[model samples]
Target: MKRIALLMVLALSLYSCDTDDDGPNLNFTIAEITGTDLPEYFEIGESYDLEVTYELPNACHQFSNFSVNPYVDEETDSTFVIEIAALISYDANITDCTEEGELTDSRTIRDLRVSSEDYNNYQFKLLTGEDENGEAEFLIIDVPVGEPEPETPEENTNA
Candidate 1:
C-alpha cells in the first residue's frame, strides 16, 4: 500500500511541473474569398490551378492555409466552399491590425478530378460574411464544364 501511495505522489509532482511558454497565443478564422482567377470553363477529367485573393483582418492575422471544402446541394452539384484559413496570433504590443487591403495569396488545388459523372458545372460558394441573423452569406459562382473529349481507338486491327 505504501508503494502505491509513493507512486501517486510522484505522478502528482510530475504533473505540476511548469511548461515553457515561448509561443504566442494563436487563434483561427475563415477569411473571405474576395477574388478568384478561374477558367471560363472546366473540362471533366481535367485538372486546373485556381488562384484566390483575400485580405487579412489585421497585422496579427497571418495567412496559414486555404480551406477548400466541398458541398453537394443536389444530385447534380459539384460545389466547393473556398476560403482563406488564417492564424491570428494575439500579441498585446501589436495595435495596427484592422487595415484591410488587397493581398493576393496563391494556392493550387492540383489534380482536382471531380468524381461525379453527371455534374454539368462547378459551383463555388464564397463566404462573404455573416448576415444580421448570423447566417453565412455566400457569393455563388457557377462555372460551366464541357463534356470530356471522347477517347480515340488505336488503328490496329489485332483481334
Candidate 2:
C-alpha cells in the first residue's frame, strides 16, 4: 500500500511539472537615424529634421518607448564629433504574430549653433543598445557659415 501511494505522488508531481510555452519571443534589430530635410552642408544656427527607424522581430513585440543620449567631443578647433545612443524597449506580450514589424519616428534638432571660433565640420556617430554590446554608425557633415547679404548699390541721387 505504501509503494502504491508513493507511485501516485510521483505521478501527480510529474504531471504538475508541465509548463506552458506560449510566450512571445521578443527581439529587436539595430536602430537607425537619418536626416530628412538636411542638406549636404549645415548652416550655423539652423534647425533640421531627422528620422529615426527601428524594427522588431515580429508583430507580437510591441514598442514601449525609446530614449536617445547625445555625446559631444571637440576633436579640434575646426572639427567636432557627436555620438548619439539609443535605448529601445518593447512590451512582453504573448500573441499570435507572424509578420515582422517596423517603427519609424521623427525628431527635430533646433539651432545647431557652434561656439568654436573656427568650426568647419562635424562627425556624427549613431548607436543603439548598451555600451557592452551595441552597434555604431557614422555620418559626416560640413558646416559652412552663411554668406552675408550684399548691400545694394545706392543710386546716385545727385545726378
Candidate 3:
C-alpha cells in the first residue's frame, strides 16, 4: 500500500511541474570591453589586479560574470593568447531597454596570477563589439613576464 501511494504521488508531481516556464526569461549577452588597467609587466608567481571596463547593451542588462579563455600558439613556444569578455544577462520581460546613445559604465577587477608556464608574454584580447561586416573586434594588450626579483629588507627607522 505504501509503495503504491509513493508511486501515485510521484506521478502527480511530474504532471504538475511548470519547471520549463518559470516567470521572467533571462538571456546571456556579451558586453564589449572598453579598457583595462594593469601593470606593464607581470612578475612570475605573483598575483596582480587586472581592472576591466565594459559597457552594457541596455538599461535592462546587468553584469553577470566574466568569461576568460586561454589558447597557446603552436608557432611560438612561450606565447599565450588570453581572451576576456564580460557576460551580461537581462530579462526578456523588460521591454523598455531603449537607453540609446548613452551607456552605463561597469568595471570589474580580476586577480591574475603570473605563472611560469606562461613564459614569454601574455596576449590579452579584450572583446569589443563586432564591426559592420559582423567581424568581432578586440583590444589587444601584451604584457611581458619577468623573473622573480630578489627581496630587499627595509631599513628600520627606530635604529
Candidate 4:
C-alpha cells in the first residue's frame, strides 16, 4: 500500500512539472515596423503604396502585418486629416499573441491627422480585437523619412 501511494505522489509531481506546452498565453511582443520600399513623399496627384508591418506580443516570434495606402494631396490643403486603413488577418496557429476573442474582419480608425510638417514622419498604429484568448493590443510604428525632393523643376527647351 505504501508503494502504491508513493507512485501516486510521484505521478502527481511529474504532472505538475510538465508545464512547457501552455499554448501561447496572453503575453505578446511587438517587432519593429516594416513595410514596402518607397519614398517618403509623393507628388500632389501621384499615389504611393504604403505598407506597415509589426510583430505580435510586442516581443515574440509571432508577427502581425498591416498594409495600406495613405496619401496627401498637394493640390488640397497640406494640413488635411487622413485615416489609416488596413486589412488585418491572423494565423489560427498563432500561439503567443494577444488578440480579441475573434479575428477582426475590418478595422477603420477615425481622425488620424496628417499635418504638413508631419510629412517627414510616417505613423503606423494597430487595433486588435478579441482572439480565442481575451485581450486587447496595439502597435505603433514610425517610418523613417526618405530624402527630400528637389525644388519644383520647370519644363525646359534644352531637353
Candidate 5:
C-alpha cells in the first residue's frame, strides 16, 4: 500500500508539471457551408469562428489563446476562399509535425476554396524566424464532409 501511494504521488506530479510554453504550438480552424453539406464559402467582409489547436513539446505550459482572422481573397472569383493564419513556435516547425521542441514560434496557414477539384484539401505550412528551405512543416490529411444521398428501395433491399 505504501509503494502504491508513492507511485501515485509521482505520477500526479509529472502530469501536473506539463505545460505549453515548454514546446511548439499548433492551431487551426475549418469551416463548412451552412447547408447541404458543402464547403464553407467565404464572402467579402464576413465573420467566422476559427477552431484552433495549440501543441506543446515539454508539456509544461498551457496552450495560448487563438488569434485567427477570417479573410477573403478577391483575386480569385471562380470559387469562394477562406484564409487561416496564426503564430506557432519554432519547435512546432520541425520536419515532422510531431517533433519535440522546448521553444518555438512561427506563422501557420491554410488556404481553402469552395469551388475547386481539390476543394476539401488544406494547404498546411509553417514559416519560422527566417526564409529558407528544409523548414519545419507538415500537411494535414484531406477531409471531406457531404450529406449522404437517400437510399432508394432497391438499395435498402440488402438490409
Candidate 6:
C-alpha cells in the first residue's frame, strides 16, 4: 500500500511540473521624449531626429522591434496633417527572468521625414500592442515654417 501511495505522489508531482508556461509578461512604458534637438517650430525641408526614453517592467525585458506608421490626412497644396502610429515590441523569453527592477531604453525615430507643406500640426498614437485594442497614448505638436518673429511696439509714435 505504501509503494502505491508513493507512486501516486510521484505521478502527481510529475504532472504538475509538466504544465505549460506561457511566458513572462513583458511590457513597455514611454517615460518621455528625451531629445531630438527639435525646435519649438519645425521648418520645411529640414530633417530632425526624434529620441524617446522608455521604461521596461524589468531588466529581463528587452526590445525586439519597433515601427512607426504615419497616415496623412487633410491633404492640401502646402498644408496637411499626419497621424502617426507607433508600436514597440519586447523579447518575451521566459528563460531569462532575472532581477525585478525597472529598466530604461532609449530609441530614435527612423525613416520619418517632414516635408514643406501647409500642415502645421501633427498627432501621434503610441500603441503598446500589435492589435488596435491595446494601450495607447496621443501626442500632438505644431510645425511652423519659420522662426516666429518678435512683435514690434509703436509706442514712440503715440508719445
Best by TM-score: 3
TM-score for each prediction?
A: 0.63, 0.45, 0.72, 0.26, 0.26, 0.52
CA lDDT of each candidate? 0.63, 0.52, 0.82, 0.43, 0.36, 0.54
lDDT ranking of the models: 3, 1, 6, 2, 4, 5
Runs of candidate 1 exceeding 4 Å displacement: 1-16, 19-22, 75-104, 114-116, 147-159
For every candidate in turn, the CA RMSD to the true structure comes to: 11.2, 9.0, 10.3, 14.1, 18.3, 8.9
lDDT of 3 by residue, 1-159 (tens): 999999999999998985777588998989989989868778778887787889887777888888999888678869888889888898987778765545656565556777776568888999997899988799999887874466798988997
Cα lDDT tens digits for candidate 5, 118-139: 2323222221222267443432
After superposition, candidate 6 runs with Cα above 4 Å error: 1-37, 74-96, 100-102, 126-135, 151-159
| Candidate 6, 1-159: lDDT as tens digits | 999999999999999897577765565533322223335776667777765555565566555544555555644434444433323445555656666765666676754566746566544444432336653444555455567678887678655
In terms of lDDT, model 1 sits at: 0.63
Quote the lDDT for 26 in model 2.
Answer: 60
Which wins on lDDT, candidate 1 or candidate 3?
3
lDDT of 4 by residue, 1-159 (tens): 999999999999999997687453433333333333334543433345444433233222433334444555355433332323233234435656554442212222333333345455554444333356755334545543444667787889796
| Stretches of model 5 off by over 4 angstroms after superposition | 1-52, 78-81, 85-159
Collision pairs in model 6: 78-117, 78-118, 79-118, 79-119, 80-119
In model 2, the clashing pairs are none
- In model 4, the worst 10-residue window by lDDT is 102-111
**Location of the lowest summed lDDT over 10 successive residues in candidate 2:** 66-75
Model 4 TM-score on a 0 to 1 scale: 0.26
- Per-prediction backbone clash count: 2, 0, 0, 15, 17, 5
